[model samples]
Target chain A: MEIVRPTLLLDKETCLRNIARMAEKAKAKNLDFCPHFKTHQSAIIGEWFREFGISAITVSSVQMAQYFARNGWTDITIALPVNILEIDQINQLASGINLNLLVENKESLVFLDKFIKFQAGIYIEIDTGYNRTGVAAHKTNLVDGLLEIVKNNKLLDFKGFLSHTGHTYQASSRHDIFNHHFDALLKMRSLKNRYKKDWPNLKLSLGDTPSASICDNFDGIDELRPGNFIFYDLMQYKLGTCKFEDIALRLVCPVIARHASRNEVIIYGGAIHTSKDSIINIDGKELYGQVIINQNGQKILLDERNYLHKLSQEHGIIKVTYKDFNSFKVGDLVEIVPVHSCLTANLMGSYLTSDGEYIPTIRQA
Target chain B: MEIVRPTLLLDKETCLRNIARMAEKAKAKNLDFCPHFKTHQSAIIGEWFREFGISAITVSSVQMAQYFARNGWTDITIALPVNILEIDQINQLASGINLNLLVENKESLVFLDKFIKFQAGIYIEIDTGYNRTGVAAHKTNLVDGLLEIVKNNKLLDFKGFLSHTGHTYQASSRHDIFNHHFDALLKMRSLKNRYKKDWPNLKLSLGDTPSASICDNFDGIDELRPGNFIFYDLMQYKLGTCKFEDIALRLVCPVIARHASRNEVIIYGGAIHTSKDSIINIDGKELYGQVIINQNGQKILLDERNYLHKLSQEHGIIKVTYKDFNSFKVGDLVEIVPVHSCLTANLMGSYLTSDGEYIPTIRQA
Candidate 1:
């Protein structure tokens, strides 16, 4: 099969191995392994997880939950804090599957109670360190207030406490990641204990790629959800979450134009194919991704010290240095390890297997 | 009409006005107007240009040209250099339309001659300051050698020179933009004069958002092509290419969560919705875009001091300043003018017109 230029190449063997490894980790810990569906977003990829005896899943949005529901996934936890605006969609989702919702505020609880008629598990999101979302972890009153609403309202089911330690992405070393995971688990355990007297069967859910990938100690946590582990990226590699060899997805882009004077090569892959996510390399330089040999599959350390400096609508400018300058020519295909593989895979909209097979993907509304 | 959160909004009136204004400028200069389709990438939007009397159009890829061809656009130019890998697609395109191709080297010319059967107009891309692509403007011998290939080849029609002065994006002021335009045109005119002695009726096509948006002078050029004018973004606004009122596209996002302590608002729109392109403000601080009134339809300064700093898959972190912090609350929708509107629009798949209307977009393979 003739492979098209600027296509995503997925190693099926590597991908399946990664899935099994994650599932094995969850099984050994005797924890509920709700692998985040946001990473692979494909029904076919989801089938691989199902092959490993994974039934329950986690999604970032109500729309994603709907997509997976249509794909025959019976149970799904919409991991994002319940956006009251999507009450109709949530209600629609709940009518079919065992839909679980997340809430970080009182307003969401009020909105859910008014709109939703069916009983849906509501997980209170605790903000351990990632200030992006969720209520403060130590806010006992906030948790009490949410539980109070649950008691008064018969529509919602209190599903204990949930936290995503997203700050683990900023970890510079393995120790930093382990510490973040340990601290977050302790916080979640404390929150569950605080509410244990009332609920008695409270569950503690912890998530984040770094926390789940590096640390095996999940003694206090009842469930684990790590998404990006399915196809780890350069950022994950830098954070010590996953090694470079473990990355399963790569963008195969053909060199359309080569600028010999400036030591630059223009690839068909752009910001649209590989996302604009960047990571500081071992040399302490910012790079979008590293270029690897298409045939030999060896890493090419290009000069000019830049990975992808500028990206237009359909063009990727790869800045090259002197040592690696003479190696590339026009029409040569190079595989790029995207900085954020999950986002990049989502953006590319399609993927080609290593053996040259096309797998179409549907976008979530 | 209930609107979905995190959608691209296009003002039809502003879009039409911008189109008419560009057409008027091209008419006054006695130049053919061929708007680049990369900005919109919509068949419906292309039809709007056609209604405005646009006969020819420009696209960044052969696939895009094919897309417009299927939509009944005949006169199309693939703006980027002819990729040898895509020669078959270009050949298929040439069979349908008056396809104009861009080329920078002898190798591409040689490779294209093998499969190209029909008469295809070839534009010798001249590098004028922007060292991204094209042959150096000062290289007469190189130009002569390339023209010789056109003279020897019967399938290729030498349609003179074309240039995209992308350096205008970095202009400090309106004068700087004008100077960049002036310098680019002067160089193109000199090359045209030098080549006209041998091949008269040589067409000079100069394109770029800055030149097309601001420059009134187009004395020697036969055609003007600019794509980004259809969706004027914050970058264009900062470059003085277009006014804030002229920015036709905006990402309509719903406020999902808010943090009172940090004075930050988390929105459903993320890096996927708004590409990571950013611009510096008046105070020398970087900002993505301004946040506008959600329901009031009034323009509000987004407390430019802060930023939409970190973004997850479906979440955006809008750092709220002390001034605007308390003004915002959970569940309030906001409009963010993307730093680069074209990239944002492309990533979004298409636009969701205000009033909850869905506009389908054409995607290139």
Candidate 2:
């Protein structure tokens, strides 16, 4: 609690603010606030969302769902395509709670249908252009077959189609993200209308932080599952989705060594702690993270030219200004706004709240 | 102990073989084998090296040094430049056993001299073209100043210059790696020769997997500190340093979804499990990791076409050949040879040994 090495510092106020804002946004849009628990990966953090009346949750892995379920979460949707290998655990999970799964193919559907003993909700993943995963929106034949298989299964409850417009992270401006969101809305709306006759209460799910944060048009969606909004990072800040203040998590690294000639301060943090997500800055330099100063218990994001330039396994080099180099001595704790908070949170495995309370990772539990 | 999800699988036999081979190399070369424990970051793995008659060890963090020290590693080197803030821990650690610290500045040396209650071995980190950290190799003035400060300090034992020939990773072939190693060898030998008259027992410390693995030319180096060789990754294999069989670690991920048309399989492992270290392949495409098949208990590296192309937080997209894709189902466990095993190992936090024993991480211990 005395803040010694590269510790992930979480501000509860900022974090709760972020969660409340997103939950309110969903409420205003008349959409289901199914917050994703993959980012924080903590049952304690899950309780924060629960405080805002969020019950339906999204997670990336079955192991995660089990972790949350063991901690008393009931309504869970694994946003990732179901790992049919984990059917035993899935079946066990679904038997006791409202378990939702994602599937993109017939083999997965058939396997679940044959093996599942309990009622399960199924969401067909639609690929709107991310090309990462999901069936193509234009593939009507595939969608129809997928739906047919789900309908045939007595235990499986056809939820709806889920699409994560991940490419919105690549959008150049807020307007660009809005366009991408509109495009996804149109795609999901069309699919929802097409299937409304068959399944009357089909819900279209859209999740992605940039689109959810930048765009206000959530009229056609039934649920919103933006996980990263809980701890918006430098990536979101650069994408214009969140301000510096909204970026809640900061890795506090100690200044280990100083290279005055280079105007650099080596920190006791690296790829292991902050991760290797570097962003190209305006100066054509790759910034692993931005330096921020924790003054009198308040974190002030430094808009200075100083940057966390490089990171090895356990070493981070922060290129600082001459004044900064002279002011900070070896062993001083400098807060860094990580490029991606989700990955950083995962790597750190836990968070040290600013109030000095140690929050255990869901994995730890 | 059935691997439920994204488990870090370590073949202990292969890992032991790797350690033995490196220890044997160091023995034959007449150099002290101080293998960096940063790769495994496990006290159990440290004990594996101890079985090979390894007494001293190298680590990247002070906390890690304490972890290994607590686990019975007496002679330890905190290889990264000393974080002046951890003087208390360093002093406490040094008082118990032989503790070596890296320093590149007079301020750090002065602070250590004034505060350190126990004697400490100091290694001036020399920059050998990596430019990431360390004092530039050509800066004799800086080196002399650093040496003078150490020599002036009564508690500080001035160890020889330590340089990591990291540029060996950038080399195209084994010949190029040899050139980088040879260049570093010359620079370190020159530094040693220059200071040999004053400090006869001063030994040169060199590390980096590519330099240590590719070239057997370790005539001048007094200590070999290569870490990554123990769990050689796709990066090391690509650098022509380690053979495919030498790779000791693999991430076992389950296939969640299958895209038959594009021959892509969505795996339940991603940036969170595998640190995003992508390497450019022969076709000039960025590859996260290579898919390896388990055939009759032997792990076979699929080197031709399959690649872990894209990764989200918990999703890994492996683009594969149609035949290979068809052969595997949604529940098959595929091993991936990570691009950088050090970072990958760091992310996973623990290992499931081939013997089915769960190895606790250094942090856990």
Candidate 3:
């Protein structure tokens, strides 16, 4: 395919393999593989999950849930804390599909209980040290208040406790990741143990790509909703969650100019295409992306010395070594493995498969 | 008028005032105001510039140039370095509009010389300490080679040196901003003096909001092309380039959840909505955005104690002060002044004016 601008290229085979591995792992452990559609956000890509007998999916917002629902996804869970203002949309979806909503506070439940008319499964989002959102796992009194509101509301069905071990992403080492995951598992299990007596068949849902990719001990967790695993990025690779080859998405950008004086190459890709998500490199500076040159029918991954160093609105400045700098010229397409695939994918809206098919995402939908 | 999701709120009066102030500044100095449209990529907003007699405009890509061209903008400069791969589009745009393109190297001119079919203006992008993209001002031999090619090519009109003093954004003080701007002025002046004998009507264009907003001196420059000043952000505010009141855009996001124990609020806005641009706060941590509580129909700017601290794919964690924390609850819409307006504006694709009208940007177009 002739890529003139910054286009996200998805390797279908690699993406399928990633799905198969995660799906197989979940099946072996007998855990529900309700992978988060927020990562791919594409209906066509969501259909790929069906090959592994996966019928349920997890989205991040009401709009995403609506998007997937329209695409024939019946059983879906919105993992984001319920925005009571979107109760109208929630009711619309809940009336048709088996929509599950997440609630972390009694206020959300109070609001949802008052406004929601259709049956919707409710998951009390339990905090397992992520501290971004969710009720603390230890706060059973608060959980009781929320569950009481759920019990009082005929439309709301208490599903179980849900936690995203997002703290695993900040792990300094694999040992740290395991420790964070294990601690979260214990907290989630404690909540399940306390509540499962009254709500038997309550399912524990845990998410975050780092924990799901590395941890095998899902003893009490019933479902996994790891999103970024489907399109593993440089951030995941840095965290040792996935191998470099497992990453399926690449941003193909055209080289516009080369500055040999500073050993830099300017590409059409920038914050607009890559979304400015960065990781610290060995030099202790921000590394925007890992650069790979696609030239002469060969893809050559440049060394750590040659990486995307800076980004503006519509310009990506790649700091390259002298040896690699001369290899690049204007009009060549260079593939960038973004620091965060989810954000990059969201920015691009659609992806061009390696075979040259336009796969529209939730943004386009 | 009712916003349930993360919406970019544009205050039309504030935005128009910003445009008038910049236009007046350019007029007072007798400098041509060809403001960069990369920030507010809306054709409707672009029309606002016409009131101030801004007929010429600057864009960062060929697609953006084409978008503006279709919207009736005749004199357009694609401020990005010429991508030889898009010669076909360049030829098409040049044939219809008074198109101008930036070229930093002889190779681009050589390629343009070979393929360009219609009359096009060429600006040799000069590196005036901003080593992102541009030829060094002192490199007269290299400049001569580029000019030689432009002189030989009948279609490529030589439009003198253009420098984006973007390094002014990194200035620690207003003095530093002046120093950076003055240094660029000196360098650009040197280039103009050396080349004016050959090309009498050559023009020097300067860009970047920091330099344009604060620096009063534009002695040697012929045109100014600042974009971000149109939507002055927290970054511009922090740099002492613009007042907080000058910021015209805000990401109005609904509060989904609030945790009192840690004094944190989770907004529906995330990396997807805000684009992850951050400014280091006084606390010496990454501050994603400054929060303004829009409760009870009154706007209250929360102190530095409360700020957006973290962002994930679909979540934004705002660290709030204990005193202000109680004022927030589920479903309250909070306004966040973004660190960088351009990226946030690009991600949002469209804006809802304070009067409740949808303003579509280039992303939406």
Candidate 4:
């Protein structure tokens, strides 16, 4: 059961616990949970959600939706704004599953009308001040035009409204994120009230990792979709979303070489495993990630004075300030907590469970 | 066979031409070409090198070596310092292929001695001022200790000295990169001379994308191991490594939605496709990449005044200028040349060939 160092180690227990916690929160709030699958795109991982009585999911692309759809996910909301160029795939997906699409403009609705045959729920994404995606909430005419096109079409169905407050991730504190989420929900509620007389059964959905993790109140929300909670990373820690112990994934790396003069220790893990994602450490120092306890399970931070400053394709350079870098001799296995687990997991390709179990990751093209 | 937008498109012809060009360069210089597989990481792509008469190949990991080994690549040099924790896999790999290991110190040589049974070629990695990995060239004692360990271990064969002038990538111009490469070569030559009496058969190996792309001289080096030339990217263009047209990979994305007031467009492509890698534009503007003419293959500067400014997991926000905002409607497809092709290709799991062909990428993990 000797797994290779610099490999991804997934704790199944923590993973299940994370999923259950999110599911429980959604259940308690009476909100439909459509967890974003982009965080962990494994079908095996999706099956774990099925165990929680979850039938619906969210994916980033049509290819990802098709992946989950083939694996028995019945209802899938393509969280991204529906690109009309892939309307053919949307038609195929809708014919099979309850495929809900997101659109921010009337132009997409007009394009979707050309290809869609079955009634598909369309979620109009509103940009509630997050300058990323979605149409501005005040753009009522755009919504009206979209609704008119949907009403005219035989296959299109106007579901409601959706928005992702992605800017919350950049929030400096919990209060900032909570306020952002609350304000976003208020905007969505106002949009819903504006169209409630016309469309009484309209659904209001909002999703974002920062808002979903910190905000406890979802009083007016209809559905919740957050992905990164499955494997909280260093960013989540910085955002006060999760504690360091809650991180479910770690890169197991081995000390390959050490330089005495520079007090730098080279490890097998590099940008490929830990990714280029970095954050300022506790000492206000920039570091790729904290060096966790090695095989001994002693979470030893390799001298705070030293930092993993640079990474090559396959080698990590840990600049140590301590004179005795020899403590971590060649062949010693070490674990690195990646700055971003989603990107790291995606880059690493597969994972080995804590119990020496190997889980091959499904490729998302 | 209309392919999905926001997909990586590869020109097989261009790839073959690039491979042939590198191979011809090595042949003319009488240098052994062990092209690093970290760039392509594809067996099919490696086959093109074999077609061009390349027998030796370089990989970043033992796992990668195993991947290429399975695909009939025999002479493989694992470019990173050997992690003894993966000795079992290395032993298994050595049994099947002509495996060579990289080491910077005697500690790694001592650690590797216990597991290797057959004589494995060990390449001493010298740091020619890169300060990333490898032992400093001035450290003759470290090299002596490494040689002593090789002399004591019957199973280990001292192959040569290797150095990756990785700092060349950070060079300001072609002249800077050329000087960096030249200085690294001179350092390697001095080290070779220092060990000439002890190891007369020692080979000199040098590699780096910037060095290979910018420097025409490979005079003193025994082998070349550049990888990024197979698929150039935005960083390469900025480094003066390749032209805009020479870039072999592009993310073909579909315009999903548009915002009129802000004059912004949302595309299906995001950080997952093009990566979070960004570069400063000509006007000291920071941008992820330039949008290309969708069908015409023309480079569209994306109205530099308004370019792809931000990216979420699966959503790319293109801030459009007020003037050209109305010209781009939903359903339009756009192509984006990525900032870092290696990371983009790794993220993009597969590629859509130029002739409407779908090619699934081989997973190296």
Off by over 4 Å in 1: A281-285, A295-306, B282-285, B295-303, B354-356
lDDT of each: 0.83, 0.87, 0.91, 0.81
Complex DockQ, candidate 1: 0.59
Better of 1 and 2 by lDDT: 2
What does the TM-score come to for chain B in model 4?
0.94
Tens-digit lDDT string for candidate 2 (A184-290)? 89888889889999999888999999988878888779999999999999989989999888988989988877777778888889888887888997689889999
Pairs of residues at least 3 apart in sequence or in different chains that clash in candidate 2: none
Q: RMSD per prediction, one decimal? A: 2.1, 2.2, 1.2, 2.5
For residue A77, model 1's alpha carbon misses the true position, in angstroms, by: 0.9
The digit string of per-residue lDDT tens for model 1 on B1-365 reads 56556778888888899999999899899998999998888998888887778989999887788888999999999888777787778888888789999988777787887778787999999999988888999988989888888998888999889999999988899999899899998999999889898889899998898889988888789999998998898899888889989998888788878888987888888876788777877667566677876436666756566567667788988877787776666677778878898888888877766556677677532
| Candidates ranked by lDDT | 3, 2, 1, 4
Ranking by DockQ: 3, 2, 4, 1
Tens digit of per-residue lDDT, candidate 4, span A293-342: 44355567564466676776678877776754655768787777778887
Give TM per candidate. 0.96, 0.95, 0.98, 0.94
Q: Could you tell me how far off, in angstroms, the CA of residue A163 lies in candidate 1 after the best superposition?
A: 1.2
> Which pairs clash (backbone N, Cα, C closer than 3 Å) in model 1?
A303-A320, A303-A321, A304-A321
Please list the residue runs of candidate 2 whose C-alpha ends up more than 4 Å from where it truly belongs after superposition: A294-301, A321-327, B138-141, B294-300, B322-324
On residues B1-365, what C-alpha lDDT tens digit does candidate 2 reach at each position? 88868999999999999988888988999999999999999988888887899999999998889898989999888888788877778889999999998887677788887898988898888887776667888788888887777788788898788988887888888888888888888888888888899889899999998888768787778999999999999888888888988998899998877888788888899998897888997678889999987766786778658999888888999989877887567788898888899888887778999889999786455
> Which residue pairs clash within candidate 3?
none
Per-candidate DockQ versus the true complex?
0.59, 0.71, 0.84, 0.64
Candidate ordering by TM-score (highest first): 3, 1, 2, 4
Query: 2 or 3: which has the higher TM-score?
Result: 3
Estimate, for each residue in B1-365, the C-alpha lDDT of model 4 and write its tens digit. Answer: 67556778898888877777878888888999889988877887777787888899998888788888988998999998887778888898888778999988776777787768776899999999788778888888988888888988888889999999988878889998989888888889998888888888999999788877667877778999999999888888889888777788888888877776667778888766777767886667667877765435555656466667777667888877787786566777777878888878777767777777666555633
The 10 consecutive residues of candidate 3 chain B with the worst lDDT sum are B257-266
